[model samples]
Target: MELQQMRYVVAIAETNSFTRAAERCLVAQSALSHQIARLERELGAKLFERTSRRVRLTPAGAAFLPAARQCLDAAERAAAQAAAAVGEVRGRLAVGLIPTVAAVDVPGALRDFRQKYPHVRIGLCVGASDDLVEQVREGALEVAFLGLPTTVVPKGVNTYELARDRHVAVVAPDHPLAEESTVDLRRLSAEVFVDMPAGTAGRIQSDLAFSAAGLSRDVAFEVTSADYMARLVGEGLGIALLPSAYVPRLTGVTTIEVIDAPSRAEYVIWSRTVCTPAASAFLAILGISTGPGTPDRGPVPGSSVRVAAE
Candidate 1:
């Protein structure tokens, strides 16, 4: 019979009195009796043997009461688990990161988040901004730290400003431009440069800056990863322009300031459709600096603006 009918049968059997069971269940005695009677008629078995003084369980009722209780319990537990999966921060989070963020303090931030929510599974995929955006839009990733400008964030995705890390020129320490506090755009024009591949946000920004200053680029080497770019610069392969923070572990490379091009901002973007508990929790950690983009500065030219997420 109906789950409610089963509940009524179990309640009456436990109390041994329809009146007491109705009171325990917060229902009218007549209603409870009707439900239990309906259950017995549907099952073709009497659930209870009743007298004016007491209600006793029939043989079939004794056999079925525990099963009925278990069924109800299972239903309730399933509902609770579904809610926990939706609202609690205890599940898998798949995230995509750009080259610049992989070099930044995201690992530290994730460590902190893991300490707070150890049960959450964190999966990371590192790629260019365009690729990461595509992953997020396609639901391959829940969210991502992506380089912007040319990326078309799909309609169902949302964006948050994290921090803006500016671009700088990295050269061999012994290069003529290495000692310069800040090089003019004209000085970089004729130099053979190690550049990011054409599709990346850094490449687009670099191209725009050169074009805006009425200069043309001289290509020496091309690489996709920022880490590789740094190594190439360290080896004196050629000068390269890259995000300031992405320059990690520079041995012989010196990062020089770019005096002309600014306005670079980095953001964390995600889907608005839905997010796992782990994804939401990580977003909370990344959004802590919810202010404006930090201005660029440094001995070479590294400035980070810490923006808090709203």
Candidate 2:
């Protein structure tokens, strides 16, 4: 079927409402319906099961959607490559990051990239370090900023170590340890904690540190958001250990330097297969260089520091 038909189908499937899809696609509902009907007739199978209350993909539609999406992405990349040959950099720059990214100011970096390459479409996703690395490797995201324990290395994607810093203790203002200027892991471990979910890259650093010291901690609350973790500490729900860079911005809490705390390493990762021109430009803007490509990547401009992500 036509690319336009595939676009309409994807929009409808994503929105699950014909009216909403039409609004999103900037097309009339009737025209979208007409295109889907025409495509279904040509394929000899209906794509969607429509009812008065809801619209969902049929088995045929579900089977065909993945290829349709791949074709659309490939078409966009082809167009981007063609534009690149003409000395123009205009395409999607999909970047993923963790909530506690501290090395480079993400908003400032993105703002500069936008100012220099106004034609590029920027996309952002926030996730855990492991998930972001996987997204970069799979081509879902062209670049990502991650934070993990110093002992662990990101696998599969190209990585650049950005910064390394120790975690600090966070507690409510009236908490017993709030008056302390510095605390070590032994003292901090004795208190209940608010931490990231178990087994995630975000949690691993602290987990490893405590284990290495032969200490055990009681995690009273587990959350995904760093802000929420801070909030829990502020509310006296529990104390927490977080990257030092993050403590200054948090409210209602007191930060205590931890002399022997877990250390987190920040990294910027990009796809090993294809460093899209847009991705390359963003990396250069950060003064990061991944060197020449290995058959699939485009020319990496503004490259100076050639280094591995490990």
Candidate 3:
């Protein structure tokens, strides 16, 4: 019946081991077992089926699990609301960013967010768009900036489109197509291409464009970093297709617009189920309005101009 006991039950159910659950709960195994036993006795039902090999929730425990989680979430939200009422945004806010998020003024946003809510601890994690999106869905991150194709947002997440940039082709200055203002993708079908690995947002967009043109590219190299891709293109190793924002400034490389390329859209995404005060504050700093659900808003004030993605 106690919140602590509920936490113990939920942790034990999740971990499936008393020893591990006790470790997670920061309590002795004996004490955790005692509490669970007490709860079972009070409820007049066995909540868990424990064996040496594994632990699992019994019928009653399985039925009670969701309510236990709801109670914990409600309690946390209540505490956060109380803190917000006092205009205090104080908690850990884990924000995820793609490796090439230079389009957003992340540092400046963080600086202003910290200045306004000094007690809010911020943790930034850089990752690929897919991985970051999964983390947001799993509640591992409060929010993230991701580069996505024109696709539906994940079911449990809400996204606000931040910006969109056209995909462009980069090549050595001496390359035949370098002088052109724009070129058709079909013209480059025979050339070896340097590109991000498959499954990345940039790579997916490039693939779609090529597929649309009924062309296939010879991928000479698969790189993860945009800067490295630029370096390879600058060395004349291979031509590359990248989001215009990720086209690096290099003396030997020239970027030309892809005449019929698919554009990459950058979005700010978060779980629809949870929105902490710190997360809300960060969104506000980015010029997004947080309400009952996700709202479509404009760019961050003074950040409308596009910048090269690092």
Candidate 4:
């Protein structure tokens, strides 16, 4: 059977509905049905059992699914390698970025990347670190910028340290702690805190920071998005502990050193098993000594950016 037919089969298996699969694959439902029928005829077995409400893969289809996926992955990788050889890196590169990075580095980085590799089509998605890591594992993203606790790399992917951003206490300007150049964590022992939801990388770090001081966090609210947390802090909701680099200078919000808060490391992760030419080119752009890549190579002499707080 042709690769197109295999694609149809895989899509159908994923979506569990021919109409939905056809929509995702940008083909007509009739065309997808015909292709699947052709594949079934070639294999001499029916691949799916469809009823009014459900679609189920037959035994043969279930067994053949992995092989079909491998075939498609191999074919796509081959095409990407061939395109790279001609020095034309033109394909879709799906990238995942945590919200902070998306808000800060992405604007300038994309401007440079697009100018340098104009032919490469880039898709950007923003999510939490854990969600982004899962996306890379599932082939939804070719590369991602993740804020993780340890250096434990994602399975089947290579990790490159990108930059280190510090965690700081954010509060409203003109608040009690705003004018202080820096303050220890204990100073806010009684204040309510706005923090990331439990089990997230950010929340874990926040917990650790407080735990180290023999204190438990008094969370005023749990939030999922960094931007939302920042806005909440700006509204005088509560003190928020977040990466210092991403805290916007909102009119009422102020950021100060959380003396003992944990510093977070951001990493660039890409699948070792899947390398597209467009992904490779984007990686190249990220590898250069400029942009977000520069901060990882230790600190430069005369560089204004602080890698760590003294």
TM-score (all chains, Cα) for each model: 0.63, 0.91, 0.71, 0.79
Deviation in Å, model 4, residue 174 alpha carbon: 6.4
Better of 2 and 4 by lDDT: 2
lDDT of 1 by residue, 1-310 (tens): 6777777877887778899888988999999988887878888999898888888988999998988986774564455457566765655678788766632367777787889888777788888877777777766787777665433333456766454556778898988888899986688887888888775676887788788888897877888877788788778788987666666545568888788743355667666555554566676665422224421211112312243211
lDDT, model 1, position 11? 80
RMSD of 3: 5.1
Stretches of model 1 off by over 4 angstroms after superposition: 1-87, 102-104, 150-156, 288-310
What does candidate 2 score in Cα RMSD to the true structure?
Answer: 4.0
Candidate 4 regions off by >4 Å?
A: 13-17, 20-28, 52-67, 102-104, 134-139, 150-156, 173-176, 179-181, 249-252, 289-310
> How far does residue 260 in candidate 2 sit from its true spot (Å)?
1.8
Clashing pairs in 2: 159-309
Q: Write the per-residue lDDT of candidate 2 for residues 1-310, one digit (tens) a residue.
A: 7999989988998999889999999999999999999999999999999899999999999998998988888888888888888988988999999998876678888888999999999999899988988888878999998888988878998877776778889999999998999999999888999999999998999999999999999998999999999888888999999888767778999999898989988878888888888888888887776576432222234433222222
Model 4: how far is 84 from its true place, Å?
1.3
Candidate closest to the true structure, highest TM-score: 2
lDDT of 4 by residue, 64-183 (tens): 999999789778767777778887776678989877652225556567778988877788887888888888887778888777664344556666665676788888875788889888
Best by lDDT: 2
Task: For candidate 3, write residues 68-139 as lDDT tens digits.
Answer: 987886786677778998987876688998766656778788888889899877899888888888888877
Give candidate 3 regions above 4 Å deviation. Answer: 1-80, 248-252, 300-310
